[model samples]
Target: MKPTFIKKGIGFAIASVIAGGSYAETTESPVSKNQQPNVVLIFVDDIGYADMGFQNLRDDIVTPNMDKVAKDGVVFSAGYVTGSVCGPSRAGLVTGRYQQRFGYHDNIGPRVRDKNVEQGLDLSVKTFGNYFQDAGYTTGYIGKSHDGDDKKFWPHNRGFDEFYGFNNGAADYFISGRNVENSEESAHSSIHRNDEVIENFDGYLTDIFGDESVDFIDRHKDSPFFLYVPFNASHGPMQAKHSDLQKFAHISDPLRRKSVAMTYNMDVNVGKIVNKLEQHELMENTMIIFMSDNGGKPDNNGSINSPLRSTKGTTWEGGIRVPFAISYRGHVPANQVIDDPVVSLDILPTTLAIAGIEEKEEWELEGVNLMPRMTGKVDKLESRYLYWLTAARSAIRDENWKLVVPNIHVQNPRYELYKISEDISESNDLSSQYPEQVERLKTEFERWNEYNEDSRWGWNKDRYPYTNGWRGRE
Candidate 1:
């Protein structure tokens, strides 16, 4: 399963065009050894690949703050997440290990009170909270959580010193109390401030989350802190404030207009966080990372992942591939783009490396440190193949070569292969033309898949809850 030089990624294509006819870890970093930078990771939910202005995939969508982040940071053109959906993807990112390594391959619905449903992130695994807290840094988690609904799985108990957010997948942006059982339930759906149900301020949920993150930064600016803000913007149950909606009135499509307005609110909050960082003179000393939990789901939210094939849930480029960027002032070069394959798993290791911490093997982390690759100290990662597997769908990607096993529930399932670099949209099916490549990739994928586990409790899994659980698509 190891990827060697024999399997070339986008690196070779760039190398072929470079002056030396080769590529190496040659870019020098401008970071000093004496300082410890504040790490802020902003994780957005169900953001479209082409939605951000930085991606430039569409004309109607506008995201200035995210675009600015891309302009001032390094964008990974081939950035990927572990899962095409939520729970598993976040599990992999938080632990720095493949989610399958811990048997969390499906979505965990909103059921914190259901004793029969064993939901939430496995407490056995350490998260960004544990990593930074152990290193004497104040840690805060603010945003929507697909991790779990139970108290034990809550942020404060899982390494973060301060926690503020909701327990389920989606929450109403403007209101919470309603006759619907899913709304305003303190245990499962309502907003909470450090373990207690609290009313959201007179602003939208996205704005509230952003303000909370800004407050966290302001309170911790004097000390080294780690802030994880996973905003549930532009997700399902789309609702936008009148203020934002008025701005996007020109958008004729009602669904798209609402989606764009919601996203615009998210962008404004992101800008707020950035302005706070600059206000406290922590811009250069703070390491800011921005990315989505997974690709957009057009059917659920009016997200447009153009030139990306399909929407979320499937293992297409649109499902797993996402916009990933990092800004570290002197440490990371701005406006640089890394076309070589990289994944959400690399985030933890990269954070540890830049923070002067040694990633212990006892952790059994699967992701490689991305700082070296970004700094040109290393040209490529040792991991040759990035994999995503579940009961219904799975995929294996090596550089530009990708072989996808569509949902087994399909009427007639077949393997699909694509040279992703040349076919970004994944429109062409090369399986028939390259049977040998398909067979080879399938064989390798099977071998690699042997070590992973099946989905936890959704769709094909044995356990199931009343709502928010995975209901297979018709």
Candidate 2:
């Protein structure tokens, strides 16, 4: 059964009584000659394009603090996640490649028993943490951690020097309970600080992450740091402090009201960290990038994916498209918005570029350095065929045209093509009118898939189509 209004209201109240809010950060500006600028990646779960103030979301929702970052940095109007869901999307972000390329498309198995014995990032793959650590940066990860379910695959094992957050996708604000159920059978949904479970946290989860981030900076002020702040806010089993909910009580939709409150809390925490950066005079040297793991789960809350069709768990614009912004005072320009298409896979390369790391010609990385585009060194980003595929569907988008083949398991699936520019919501299908364009895209997708291997999902020719299964989607 769906959550009722009264149930949600009571949940909010319980969350409030247990979760308080108090935050503080470092004040000294410590810069080292050999140290690179501090990197802060604020990754919010299940937020949508219309959730932020700059996005002109429903006027009822408030996100002024996040708007401050957009006002001070370049906001990418057309930013996208690697996948529409959290696990694979995060895997792609961490590895700088499509997760399907490595067979990590599914969530990690439960903590108790391995339903499928799924593995976290293969030790073979390199993570952003590995790169940053190799470059001498002190890596710290705080808040929701979903990349791995097993303690062996924790953030500390994935290249982060200091890890303080839950191991699953979502945890309770104060109680630190695993709010969302994982597909894995034995996984326990609980909170942890380092390797130990947290019996009690003094404040809300969002506030805890922000305060920990500040402390991480204070301890590593003399050195370069990479801080990954992944908040469990706005993702369900909806919970937020009462003060935040009271601010949005006028909203009639109980789900949406809770969403607004959670988002407001996230924004306030963002403001807290940004203020810390300024106080330490490290704002100029800090490179902060804010993005969501995927599109919002509309059913879960008021996470809006307006002007775009569908929601989380589908291969639609609303499912993959998300709000993305980058801020580095004196480095990235203020108030610039890049509407061109970009993906989460590009973050690793971009961050490396910012930290003065250059890739060898033979490195074989998929993402390009976005610094040129962000710094006005280039006119625009290079265009390439962006592809999406899932067990049930497959799609390819180039420029304004997109081709979707739903129910791919069938022998003769109907292909529907649409001009996305003319129909941003994907309300129309024009496949019959443009057979040539459809064939061209289909052929391109086939060609790309031919050279790749289905590393994420073991090849199951009986269950999946495609000659070898190296396609972007399984």
Clashes of 2: 6
TM-scores, all candidates, are: 0.86, 0.85
lDDT of 2 by residue, 1-474 (tens): 211111010000012111222223445665654567888998999997678766754676567666766767788776887677787788888878877666664454322112243446777777888889988899998887775545677888888898887776666665633322221332435555666665544677788788888788778877788999988888987998998888888999998899989988987888777767766778778888899988888887678988777888677888888888888888888878776678887888888887887765554567777889988999788778777665456678876788877666688988888776456667778888889999999999888666554434323544322332111223
lDDT of 1 by residue, 304-369 (tens): 876687878889988988888888887777777788888998899888887777889899988888
Which residue pairs overlap in candidate 2's backbone?
A: 103-455, 103-456, 111-187, 112-186, 178-189, 389-473
Model 1 lDDT, residue 91, Cα: 88
Query: Distance (Å) between predicted and true CA of 115, model 2?
Result: 11
Lowest lDDT block of 10, candidate 2? 5-14
Tell me the deviation in Å of residue 3 in model 1: 25
Question: Over 4 Å off in model 2, which ranges?
Answer: 1-27, 30-34, 109-117, 176-187, 361-363, 451-474
Best by lDDT, which number?
1
Tell me the deviation in Å of residue 391 in model 2. 3.2
What overall lDDT, based on C-alpha atoms, would model 2 receive against the true structure?
0.73
